[model samples]
Target: MIRARHAGVAAGAAVLLLLTACGSHGDNTQSPAPASSTDLTHLQKLVEDAESAASSAESDMARE
Candidate 1:
């Protein structure tokens, strides 16, 4: 029937759109940036502060 043909064509177009949505276009501009020295220093300071806070909490918990 003509209705069935139209339904099939709609379904095919939907599937093709879905496939292209998920397919990679082989673009080289998606690479991640390298972390700078300042970034590393900031992250290291954050970890140190977290560790210091954890140690302080443990000390407080010990007195409870």
Candidate 2:
């Protein structure tokens, strides 16, 4: 059950990363900055969110 929740969060992060990458390609406003740096920020935030989710999942599991 824990693994399943983690997997879902991982998958969501992957999809978000892909979407962010795709959206950035067409924007020239931030073209000066490389995608790697921009994506890194997004990735970091996603990681933080994932951790929070895992914590929440753990709490929920405990209740169950």
TM-score winner: 1
| Residue pairs in collision within model 1 | none
Q: For model 1, where is the 10-residue window of minimal lDDT?
A: 16-25
TM-score of each: 0.50, 0.49
How does each model score on lDDT? 0.54, 0.73
Candidate that would win on lDDT: 2
For model 2, give the 10-residue run with minimal summed lDDT: 25-34
C-alpha RMSD of candidate 1: 22.4
Clashes (backbone N, CA, C under 3 Å), per candidate, total 0, 0
Please give, for residues 1-64, the per-residue lDDT of candidate 1 as tens digits. 4344444555555554444445454566464444556755655565565555556666666787
TM-score of model 2 (CA atoms): 0.49
